[model samples]
Target: RAASYEEQGVDEIVILDVSATLEGRRTQAETVRAVRARLSIPLTVGGGVREPDDAARLLDAGADKVAINTAAVDDPTRLDRLAERFGRQCVVVAIDAARRLDGEGWEVVTHAGKNRTGRDAILWARQAVERGAGEVLLTSFDQDGTREGYDLALLRAAASAVAVPVIASGGAATVAHLHEALGAGADAVLAASIFHDGDMTVGTVKRALARLGARVRA
Candidate 1:
């Protein structure tokens, strides 16, 4: 998949090992190492990074940046020290958030979306940046895997609250959805099922986004 993305002119690739968190292990560096050799674009790998050393191991495995979520809530200070050790540019904070039952606000979810921390998603994004996370990968768990569209309110809140770049994830089923995400203040948009299931090509999506004034290049 990463190889195909590189061929389709994706700006970058983020490879995540979803099972690692539940399994209590660091990111699969070997998997990242293989994917790195197949693409020229920057790669960000995330999964079960527990500490700065785990992140460093990913970097050594050829990932340009390392993303973390469960650890972000379990030990936010780790982000501070990681930024100090590896520079903020190499740290990406992944936020898996779901809307409250009453739909009032978003709460942070960890452990691969199994645990919900009461921390407000918007507030957490701001804190991540302040702790030196260079970017935010905001996933709306309520919208994830549904292909309905992003949670524009959640995107807007996180993007506006943080100084760092925000990448919107979950539920990009159409070009219009991508446009809406960008318009809502997300710096980038990420889709999994659309591309993984062969519903859309990166080139086609990029062209579509460009028509919507996204400045995408061929």
Candidate 2:
């Protein structure tokens, strides 16, 4: 699958063991190694990355970057340590945010969105960047798997709050959705179901975006 995405022109690939943290296990370094052996594109691996050693293992396994979520939330200083050890360019802060019930704003969620931290998403993004996260992977918990669309408001807020690049994720179902995300201030867009279920291809989506006047890699 990783090779297929590469052939289809995906700029980069992100492999997240979503259950690793929730199930109390580390991301499978062997799995990352296997995937890395097959592709030339950049890869980002995440899940159960509690410390610098975990990130080191992934990097040694060929991941271009390591993403941290639960661990960073548990200790913001973890971000500092990771950046210090691996360089900020190799660190990505993965934030799973859900809209507050009152609809006022978004809150950061950890443990695969099962635990709410009540931390304001925008503020957290800023702090993560300040603490040395090179990039932000922002996923909308409410919009994830809904195929409704990205939470543009959340994207806008996070992108505006941080100087580092923000990757918008979740609830993407169409090319227009990707374009909207970019317009909403996302540096990039991440989609799963649309590509996994064969509804779209990276090449096709890039073509559509190009037609819409959005610059895309050939």
Candidate 3:
């Protein structure tokens, strides 16, 4: 899917295991090696990256960058170490967020949304950047498959909190949603089910984003 998206004029790709950490699965270096051999664009492999070794191994296996979620939330020093070793541009912090039922604002989730950290997403994003994360991938678990729309408020807050770029993920059902995400301060937008299931194409999204005056490579 990432390959196909790249063929469709997508700028970059991010592949997350999503269940690797929860299932105690190790990072798939083979998969990254294979994909790196096949694809020409920048690729980010994430999920189950708990330490700098894991991150370095993935990059050695052909990943241009590695994303950390559960591990970073639990131990932010790992991010600093990765940045110090591989450089900040190679580290991205992914935040799995959801609206707390208690109206405590957006809370960060872990282990594929099975555990809520009870920390504000924006606060955590700020900390991640301060601790040396180059970018943030903010995903809304609540709106993931619903395709309703992006959690704009959450994106806005994260954008304001971090100086680095923020990639908005989850609930992008239409081209309009892409526009809204950018308007809310997202530097990039990621969609899975919508593109994986053939509901929309990356070319369509890129065209729409371009029409809306967003910067996208040709």
- On TM-score, the leading prediction is 2
Q: Who is ahead in lDDT, 1 or 3?
A: 1
Q: What Cα-based lDDT does every candidate model obtain?
A: 0.89, 0.95, 0.88
- Model 2, C-alpha of 160: deviation from truth (Å): 0.6
Work out candidate 2's RMSD over C-alphas: 0.6
- What's the candidate order when arranged by decreasing TM-score? 2, 1, 3
Q: Pick the candidate with the highest lDDT.
A: 2
Q: Candidate 1 lDDT, tens digit per residue, 99-130?
A: 87777899998776778788888888899999
**Per-residue alpha-carbon lDDT of candidate 3 for residues 55-113, written as tens digits (9 for 90 to 100):** 98899999999999998888889988989999989999999999998877899999778
| Ten-residue region with minimum lDDT total, candidate 1 | 209-218
Provide the clashing-pair count of each candidate structure. 0, 0, 0
- Candidate 2: where is the Cα deviation over 4 Å? none
What tens-digit string does per-residue lDDT give for candidate 2 at 146-176? 9999999999999889999999999999999
Rank ordering of all candidates by lDDT, starting from the highest:
2, 1, 3
